[model samples]
Target: MAIIAGSTITASQYIACSEKRDKYGHITSRISGASAKAGHMMRDNVFQTPTHTKEYDAVIIGGGVAGLAAARMLHHRGMNNYRLLELESHTGGNASFGSNKYSAFPLGAHYLPIPNTDNQPLLDMLAEAGILTGYNSNGLPVYNETDLCYDPEERLYIHDRWQEGLIPQLGTTKTTQQELKRWLDEMQQLRAIRGTDGRYAFDIPIANSSVDPAFRELDNINMRTYLQQKGYQSEELYWYLDYCCRDDYGAGIDIISAWAGIHYFASRKGKAANADNSQMLTWPQGNGRLVQHLQQFSKEKTLQQTIVYKVTPQGNRVAIDYYDMRLHTTQRIIAKACILATPQFVTQRLIPGGTYDHDFVYSPWLVANITLDRVPESSGYQLCWDNVIYRGKSLGYVYAQQQQLTQVQPERQVVTYYLPLDHLDPVSSRKYAIALEPQQWVKLITDDLEKVHPGIHEVIRDVDITVWGHGMIRPHTGFITGAARAAAQSSPYKNIFYAHSDLSGVSIFEEAFYHGNKAANALADYCS
Candidate 1:
């Protein structure tokens, strides 16, 4: 459309430009790697008998972080006779990335917060990946300088101009300022407080959190309700809290459990020699870099483009029936133990007649990687790693190449835009997002960007979209501490184990890694 300042683009031109493929010949559309049709076929009980059968000591169904972690744990335990199956051609699940000629960008998950010092397993993994270089004299781990997020970390477009940080401080009233201070003070106390059980009141992996009922009861109400009960009444505070919920849980304060929302603030207690807890580890390609490290452990044993439709427990073994997308054939694997690392929604279809009644509500998300010929001009602050627009429809965009160490910034820049479809229910939102046309998505994105960066359309070179129907698990009221979650975590059969972030009621890398490792440990114990 070649939109310039003070000029509007025609709908036809917008459609034309939006449909234009990137340098890699990839168009702006929903990611096509997932096996949605195969999932439907599995749901409909449309199965073909396997023409071939194989045997393995263990079988990991799904190739996301959870599954990959399971594979790594199995190898760590000296179990080499195992196979990992993935529906997509590539692994990483939500941590996947895509690239064009200019830069590589994230498809879904983009960053990892510093791991809590108590999370030794995660620390070990990061150390192995060289992200955690070594410990300092004071015992705090030192991270790789290049891997840490660079300077100009965050900024927010508020009061018609970019501010230093995301907090709406530029135009905030005294009441809002006081409320924000109170919230921060309370969160700081909560961050240091431990329960009577001697565990942190809130911790990553969620299971490691204190089991005190006083804190556990927070899961019985929504975050908004919690704020109201505490006499918090600031519009800015409410908006900022809602934004935080949407950024992490893919939902808002009204929908997320108070425990989860508070955990978002209080749980991050990671101390590093070089970076603070607020600092995050990121790359141009996002968490895909971590995935690359994890993939090495499962490289020779992982099978891509394979859909495991059915998993059943035999007398002393587990039978896994899978369909090969490339070969158009079905195969069977008999294993002594099996780990179903898929989400609960997909796991239900794989194992028919399961009695576990889970109330898992996943939030849908839309992520777009926009390639621009030049950086869009803005007021108040220069482009930062994470740039957010106050009260914007989407979470705003991240400067993808902010981690680049080159003195001369590239002429071409890529920014990943994130939008959680939480205006409606998850089902309706998913449908609405999937039904959006390429041009409609382009308009939605460009319209939002124009609000902060006027005439940004003129600089845009390409836009690639990825929609995650079941993006991440949401911890609703009572879901985290409910019986359904407990049942979902248990193994119905002796030879089968469940492992996914959904079981933790919060979809984050640490929980997924924990569950995967937990499942592998259980399987190893069973085999012994």
Candidate 2:
């Protein structure tokens, strides 16, 4: 089905239609020559009839944690006249889950640490959701003992020995260890220092931090420069830090801001009653289950399947025009308020006509999930919560079946391996990386895993791959505590609002949730 130039339809759209026909054995749309007759014919046959349901007071653009949280908060406030439009068939954009006979497992987001005492709403939400038991004498909330990460929490196979910590130490020389220690000492000092406004230099929620120019200057340089300036140049340390950045921010040290990199280690000040604030709460299904619970609070019928293309302000209401791929329709939703809970890339596309300068950049991620009949035995420590390989571009693997209370049937496990395409130009790298076939991904994961567990490929049963074209947004130099972020929060349209972790310039569950809640509350003020 070759598309003719000057035709009313786009070539890519025609190709997509062809693929659908080939795979599904049906075609309802056509790509004909440009004419009103062709347009009318296509519109009559291809366009999906819009659901003439009652209008919504507000429409949330995403179905991820942020969107769901916004919906949940709005619903709790007795604002049930809202709708959530998600492009995917399922909710929980990144925080998604999958299941088979063995058990349900997380596909993307998996772990969440307890919130700080200051994060009362999050703590309350978790407690209401039965994730917390109670607070201890120190005011830290205790998580369900059963919910804590099991024994053999983490192990790093480095220097031919399985080390107890994620930080590289096995094959490191004295000089490397000393350098690592020195780097940590500097972070500790930064952690202890407070700004002129009596705020912690590296505080969560970002806005609460000090406005000191000296500290804010750290955001001007990339993490690599920051480390280089401090004389912290050890290959092992560099690899470990780079791996950490890739795992969380989806970018390497050079692309990430120094202050943002430091915040990854220093900003978490959460305290728990029976557990340390530093510890995380996770399940085999990842954070997907949490996303599910949040979705339950919203109106399922109001959830539309549409990819928002652009948003235009029309008086007191915002006109949201979106293309529904499934129904092959383009429709508009007018609402008193709107929340753009999408990533920066999508956000940029939506507000192209506006004057918003969001300098946020994002990185791409490639994740491979392998189902094995049995995990290959490791030479160093036994199978732990997270098993990582030494000196690899990838961050090793996580046992997706480990958190199940029910025994894994047939004695098999699933391993989710992650590799961030942290190239100098992530956009181009993502395009090239995405073009690789599934077998290519399987081969990469199998070969990488075989190094630690030899002859393990024979036991593999299935492998699935997911690509985050624009995964986590990077907080480059000057992003954290910058004015661009402040300006982004300002209203672009009278009724439209922006809520995404990307806007915060830091990609974390806390930031995502915080953004959602803030957007919801801010919009709620105009409800009357």
User: Which candidate number has the best lDDT?
Assistant: 1
Instruction: Give all TM-scores, in the order shown.
Output: 0.94, 0.86
- Residues 4-74 of candidate 2 have per-residue lDDT tens digits of 11112345654554465332222111111112232233233344434433356888888778888888888
Task: Enumerate residue pairs that collide in model 2.
Answer: 105-285, 106-285, 110-286, 140-273, 141-273, 219-477, 219-478
Residue-wise lDDT of candidate 1 within 124-225, one digit each (tens)? 999999999999999899999999999899999998999888888997889889999999999999999899999999999799899999899999999999
Error of 1 at 210 (Å): 1.4
Error of 2 at 5 (Å): 37
CA RMSD (A), model 1: 4.1
Task: State residue 17's C-alpha deviation in candidate 1, in Å.
Answer: 12
Each model's lDDT comes to 0.86, 0.72
Q: What are the root-mean-square deviations of the candidates from the true structure over C-alphas?
A: 4.1, 8.1
